[model samples]
Target: MDIPAALGGVSTALTIVKQLNDIDRRVDEAGFKLRIAEATSALAEAKLGLVDAQEDIRSKEAEISSLRSLLKRKEETVERSGYRYRCDANKNPIGTALCPVCMDEGRFVLTIQSDQSGRPYVCPKCKANFGYLSAFQDP
Candidate 1:
């Protein structure tokens, strides 16, 4: 479930713990006279259960915090990397002068295709030969 739902569950657990503590005190004061030993034991057990529930809520909250941190980091990385755009011949950018491949703009098509990969690749759609950009060094 989402973070908000998990937080709500944690809140519910806290409320239950508070109620259990109140019950324990009431039972000790009133039920003690009727069944002193049994009431004491039951109250002790309920307190232990409440402690376990509290631990569960803490762990769930920690996990949500960790996930939020990871997402924030990924978003930062995408923002830093400028997109690569493709250009065509005549020094014009491809697809509205936008590099459809890397989504970068303001780049003219490299005069010659790169072949740094040492292998010829054909475009699957146009059957045209293209080289790897790594092979072409910036002039």
Candidate 2:
């Protein structure tokens, strides 16, 4: 459930608890039965709120895991010129140039393609062009 729904459930529980506290010392059997029913409903709502909170925690944990994995991949890449490239075991840059725009956004490192002139690299995913020395050129 969403945060607002969870909060609503908790709020309803608190309200019911306050009402139960305000009951008179000399209560009739029917009045006690009604209070018990209200308390049970409030408890159910509170349980739902707890379940929602647990689900939210699990979702956040999954997101954190994914971000950590992405960060690890980013750490393994090095930026050269205007593009990003994967590094070898020795930390040496390797493979084709990756889209710098995508890399900075924590997206996958899409390989930038070379045009006929080979003077600039173009990213197929974002269509962003990086003006740099051709990959075929000797540095």
Which model scores highest in TM-score? 2
Report the poorest 10 consecutive residues by lDDT, candidate 1.
95-104
Cand. 2 Cα-lDDT? 0.71
lDDT of 2 at 76: 87
lDDT string for model 1 (96-136, tens) is: 11122322221223223224444653333333454432222
Q: Give per-residue CA lDDT, model 2, range 1-139, as digits (tens).
A: 5566666666776776677667774766567668678767866776777788889899999989989999998888777775667777766667677787787777875555565655566778888877663342213
Candidate 2 segments whose C-alpha is farther than 4 A from its true place:
1-27, 133-139
Give the alpha-carbon lDDT of every model.
0.42, 0.71
Best candidate, lDDT-wise? 2
